[model samples]
Target chain A: MNFILHISKLDKYFDNLHALNDVNFDAKDGRILGLIGQNGAGKSTTFHSILDFIKYNGEITWNGNPINEKTFDEIGYLPEERSLMEKATVQQQIVYFAKLKNRKANWTKPRIKNWMKKFDVKGDLNSKLKSLSKGNQQKIQLICTLIHEPKLIILDEPFSGLDPVNADLLKQSILEAKANGATIIFSSHNMNNVEEICDDLVMLRNGEVVLNGSVQAVRNQFGKNELYVTTPMPKEELRQLPGVETVFVRDNEKYKLKLSNPDAGVELFKLISKGEYIEEFSQQPPSLDEIFREKVGETNE
Target chain B: MVKLMNKFKAIVQETYVNQVKSKSFIILCLLPIIAIALIVIVGLISYQNAASSGNDDTNQIALIADSGIKKSIVQKDGDSIDSSIKTEQQAKHKLKNDDIYGYVKVTKNNDKYTAKYIGNESIDGGVRDDLMQNLSLHQNKLNLSNNNLTSEQIKKLSNKPSFYNYVKSRSNDNKSDDNDIKMGSLQLLIYILYFFLFFYSSITATVISKEKGSKLVEVIFSSTTATKYFIGKITGIVLMMLTQFAIYLIMLFSSYAFLSQADFAKSFIKENSNYVHQIVSNLFNINLLFIIFGLLLGIILSATAGSLVSRREDANKAGQPVFMIVIILFVLSIMFQNNSNSIIPKILSYFPLSSYFFMPIRMINNQANIYEGLISLFILIIFIIGLTYFISKVYKGLMLQNNNEGWFKNLIRGVKYR
Candidate 1:
């Protein structure tokens, strides 16, 4: 896939500590790339470098070319840190961001209206930012990030401080931005949203990318032969089945068995077939969160 | 170009709206109102106190002299004497009078005239000087009559002479106050400008530095170059200043209109006429224009400069340079008012920071010509532009520093990088 934003062998240092070490990645059009890491794992530093807020030794190319002085107007950045003046009104703040992207307020006003409506912001534009709820302010920030219709939108912790309804509204907007041919890179600690929205994932540990690939591919790569059997059998009965070393009972009658490395799921199915009716017996792979922990050796949560 | 301009406009709008939203703007707007009210209340009370105090007098003196000599010595056409022995006596008596001031006794003896002046306080040096010069003329006349000198000789001696005292400095060549009413108005000019510039520039600095110090600078920087952002900030500040000043001017004019009865206000309006002439004569008093323009240029330049070093503690430090300049410029302005044509101040006016003082002094001193004023004004304009540009260049990098160490290194780094 062609990447809208590509960072090649990026290196960043602060004093003695290497903040980002030889990081390489690509964020393509029409997709949300989830960047997951523990706190202080260079997630914010990487974003800052890409957005030209920091000086680092690397080439960050946008649309197959280096980001020189001129490319600043093309990308829109929503930093994890809040940046709006609390004294300023919502309309004023959005207009300011839009103007920075080199568009007039009049031109961006209609788009702002659409975005605020889309985000389900229920407030007056004339009200100052401090007067708005945190969730509403966050939504305003999201609208500001996307108001210019940027080609590459970087959302750092966009779902932060948002309720489910508000988060869902933001998610819809993020998806809309993606659908409009803008590439999105979403960084958040909220794994549920990450699991739902991201198709590609990059897991970082100690300022290094430990895993990167399609989400399903990464998840499918690290897992055991799994089966879910819901039957009349209890936890003790499932454990006694041939080739099953351990059985985990879930929701009373539901049973999950772990087979030996050489053993296959065929044995578990045969044991469950003896029942008059087998409720749930299926092979399943590891989830993304489980795969993340397996690959990085540290639970993200 | 379109895109860049759009971005700049948006930023300017942002700055304008944000600043207007600030509690500071409201505070700034209130300052002038409070000042004007304070001045009016204080002025009216003082005027009333002075008016009631004006009736302190106890005595008067009558000058008795022979009609022929008094007529010859004092130029009086009729009963009402524009220049007379009685006028002089009245001035002296006003000095003596618990009911009057003080009284002077004038006597004429043949060709020579003798005069006596007595007062509680010594007569003002200026008035004393006037009396001595007239007495000296009377002595010269007596000498001319005794020596039997010709009228032509007397005319040669008595003719008003040209004042030719050339001052060629060790390094240069050049030549070169008021009633209490005028003096008070002039002093008011100093305090008013001082109060307003500090109010305006410090607020601008604080507001700009605060915005940049917080997270917003990065957010704003992402969409445009620092220059455009700087322009936007400056524009917003200018708007804020103009708003405050305009309000002040309105209050000032309103007070002038209402308090037309008070001596100070009358004096202020009288000086306002002088200000008009000061402006109109600006075409001739090129020196005045240069000084005013130089000060103006310096203000705008330093305002931007103050922003360059803007950070957490920078407002305090940068404000020092700005206010220090204001204090210095104003001190020179006051000193220049007294000397008007001092050689040193004249040269100082040609400079960037000091020139603001120098130009005005030269003009008021009657030393600077229109040509010189214009030349200095032009130079001042260029210098301010160059300095502002330099500051903005430094500001672009300074805006990135979050800590003290970063601020110092980045200040230099920004300059070096540029």
Candidate 2:
């Protein structure tokens, strides 16, 4: 059905401060998109603009139609902060959120029970939300987000405050939603989780897109200038190499070196072959963390 | 359109049900019943005390008259009097000793007579009536003997009327009673409506502020438009209030009916039946429609005030000024209640918050015509609609405002920037 959501030239201003600037992104059907940035880096602002929660100078379209109220029915969103009615019962809260997504109670009630079990939540349907622990409350919130089986899901920091076990459970839930052909977009400060789950990523820095592409592609764009090696040579000798710009100990015996030239690996290989005994040497592209820092760091400079 | 409707319905249902089922709501609903029970119990205790005390005063009196009028003080049929011979001091002692219900002291000079009654405190009405009747007879006999008038002449003189009072109309007397009833009933209606308006609006404010405080509003806004969310909340809260009010009215009437079933309360109920009917009928009339619309405006204002603060704890502080404004209007309505025909009250009837109380009171007093009442109502509705529209526009922007500054500063910024 061509369920591609597109956002273009999005600009949002909060008073005199620019919150989002000329942001662009897309989420194709059955793909999970990650939005990663430091605090106040316009990640949340972009989400708000796309959901139409705030007015912005941009266009957001679903299947070539402008986003509207009907467009929201197929979208499930969990805001960055936990939004809940604390005094309400567990069943009541989930039903209310699901109903907002245009699902009937008769259809949602049983599904909620099933989701509750899948999440390993101990409380019954009638238990008040306040009675549950923080982790349990988060699980219940996750259940509310997925109970309606929305075609698109947007979760902002869905794993915050969750223990490792609960976070794993949440990751599985997101994966199941993706398996069901829903487009998923989530923002998180945890790079490992984002790298593990996201097929495409859009990184923001100071209200501008610093990087946007698939995980492998973004890493490849940074090139393979970073090299890791284990050798008998001291750290000072590695620092004195011709094309080496920076050298730091990766560990006691391993050194991570950044090269001034992308093809420095060839020169280093010749040196190792001549006399120096090398235990291990490999040329590798930068990690997502390194690329993120470089992109955001460039903007800072 | 269908999705909007569904979202609206869902919001209303959840809001209404959650609030209605809360413990605070249950307590509020039960308050009127408890109050009515308390009133009945207090009334019954007072009535019982009066009944028991009156039983001790039946057919008891001690007469200590002057010797000269002793013969003239012959007791009438069914009269019981103790004429014990004692000095004035002795009689006072006897009265304190509970030896008699009361003692009457009589002194006669030539053809003039004077009397004073002393008892434990004061004499009963029945005893007073009997004593005065006997004293009058004694005086009349003395006059008859002094003038040497025969019985026939005395009867003939009494038959000739000397003065007459006649009135062309009794409408003034009836109109005063109607005015009293209408004013009393209208005053109560306005007080209750004002209280409900304030209370329900506070509820709305609390709900809004709490949603923001918990950071749930953004997610909610993403699912529905601000207008639908605001209207749904207002509708839900108003419906809850109406349900509460209906329960209170039922409890009030049921308590009345129960109290009236007692033989003692029948007269009290009968005396107030017309006023009760007047209040009930006026409450169901067009005046009630005005009050409802006015209450809607109050809720909208509360929503505006509530949106200023980002935390629930600040809700009361944020809404305090608006709440006080409503209270001031109520006080104004009550202060000028008796002056319904005066210019002050007439002018207040056209005002916004004041009209919720003033116009209804004016209408009840027959000082405001149908046109004025309708116009007052119309103004209130328009004001509310405009405010709601304005609030809806600013609500989304305000919800996104996570300012760390004071609420007033944020409020100013929201108004200017949003």
Candidate 3:
């Protein structure tokens, strides 16, 4: 139940602009923390603060100790930009990174092959990094990031350029790493993917944490007023009913409706059931995407 | 502490291996060796060719005259009696037919004399000296005759003032020769050091900036301090420069040894033995510690400046200060080539930037003693350490700045802000 990582009262400024303002968050030892924000929302800046790459007013600790060079010994960081030497071959690049982490060549050479195989990346070990396609290069970068089996992995926009299949593969790898007890932290604009793998997330708006909790808890806090209805009636009829906010006809002649209140659910059900034969009415908590939009929308207003 | 050392060593090793294996570095290192070897080979071939040609002593030329002074000219000019008189057409025909190397045609026009010399080969220095002497004697006789004086008076006038020039001591001449050799060697060392400082430091800057642009600096900084990264990078480039210098030395020594075994090369080298002896003696006799320490400090200083760059495109901006120092050093080396004894050169030799050029010159001129050189080196070492420490302090924050500002501004800000 103890926090593996914690940052409280984190603040950063670049000139006159405030970048991160008293942002507070934490992650458990074996869970994934999704950092969700738009461009310039301070996700990358938060990561930078934690890694000590920039000067900031903050307190960041891992296992009750202030972060330092030793913190990186057990941590892996994949920068938003590709951090690789293009002219160097795959073997040279991997060995260079591994050696920087104090991994011996004898141990790293075999691990490189094993990781490349697991990632299903097909290329010669001696091939230069620039010769590989973007996806393959990303896979190699990922291997370098994860090969050390670090206790904490911080991936900044890890899925930026990944295709769907590669992203799925990466998701699986991340899950496996989590199962192996590594605390994973990542920042992404893709809400669906974030919801898929993240147990807890912090949503930042204008350098401030507006929503911070487990995905399920945060969604449940937003409350459940959405219902999927399979009916013969037109979707407009549901919108005209009292207590209904909006309705959309989904696939297979089903109408997914958003109600103004959970109490309105009975009214909409009664309205829909009175007119046409209703197949089923199921209510569910709001999606993380809806919660993110709702929280970010308030700040925008 | 052990982990830091290990990371530094790994970074140095990686930089060394990557640069050493690169085609550009390999080619850059090899070019100077190849060029020097080609120069030596070309010099040998041309020397042999010049030796095979007949000596200038054997060539013959004719002197034609239409003046009353012709016989007197020939008698006054020693070694000129071998020439046979001929008309202008005959001389030209002989020259064309290879019967004569060249001919000098003398004719009287108006009241003065005009001489025209043409030949297939350039007139030799000894021949030209004798001809000028004979012509001066003839002009003196003509002047005496026009003054209504007799030949006896002219002869007495020419023979009266016989003066001899002599060196009071050979040791002074040898010392001067040794100084020339030392200065020459020092100038050469200055050029080589300038090349190393300017080229290698710029390379280091480019590498740093390129890594910065790609976010590799973030990855490296995570595991090690900025000081370690700076030291490792500079050390890596220093090792590269040393490797290249070592290879060039090997090539030079091996070539010299190989050439010394051949009779032609040996004889050719012997003809310029005085120069060769001076160079070899200066190489062994000069204080090498000054040169080594000076170069090391200069390169480190340049590398420290280079680390301030944030992007590869602005590498020139980052490296400009070092390049300017090198250019100033080169210009001073040239300006003070013959004036190594001056106070200005000696004073400049104590500075860290110009010392790489000036210290060696002073050492070669025998003006800088061991203690003086060592003191200068000590000051330079201290300066290098201070600059490195200062730059390391700023390097971490400087590298993290995306550098939307100009490189110079970023550099200043990084240093000031830190």
Per-residue lDDT tens digits of candidate 1, residues B1-418?
A: 7656666666556656666667877876677678778888887788787777655332223233445444543442222222333565456544444444344466767666777766564444544455556567667767877897777887787778689986543221221112332344345545545665666667666666666655677777776777777766676666655565577668756765675656656776565554444333432344434434544554464445454564545655555557777787777778666675667677776777666555644654457776776677777877877876877666656566544543345456556432
DockQ of each: 0.43, 0.71, 0.53
Candidate 2 residue B165 C-alpha distance from true site, Å: 9.5
**For candidate 3, lDDT tens digit of each residue in B1-418?**
7875788898899878878888878898789678867867887788877877644433667778745545655665536323564577887887787766777777656545667788898665666666666666666656776787667876677676667987664354677666666667766676666676677767776777777767888888876777788889878877887788688778777767766766657766565556766665654443455556555665665565555666656656666766777788788888985687688888888877666567667766777787787777777778778877877777787777765565567677776543
lDDT tens digits, residues B1-418, model 2?
A: 7767999999889889988998879999999878877877887888888778755533455666755455445354125455653567776776666666667777778887677887766765765676677777788878888998878999975584567777644344577667777877777777877787778778878888888777788778767887788888888988887888789878987888887898667777887777677677866787888777877778777777677787767766666656888888887777877788888888878887677788888888778888989999988887778878887877777766767577668777666654
Tens-place lDDT per residue, model 3, A100-129, is 777777878988888898898979899988
Per-model TM-score (chain A alone): 0.90, 0.92, 0.94
CAPRI-style grade of the A/B interface in model 2? medium
State each model's C-alpha RMSD to the native: 8.7, 3.6, 6.4
The candidate maximizing lDDT is: 2
Measured by TM-score, how close is model 1 to the native structure? 0.67
Candidates ranked by TM-score = 2, 3, 1
Better of 1 and 3 by TM-score: 3
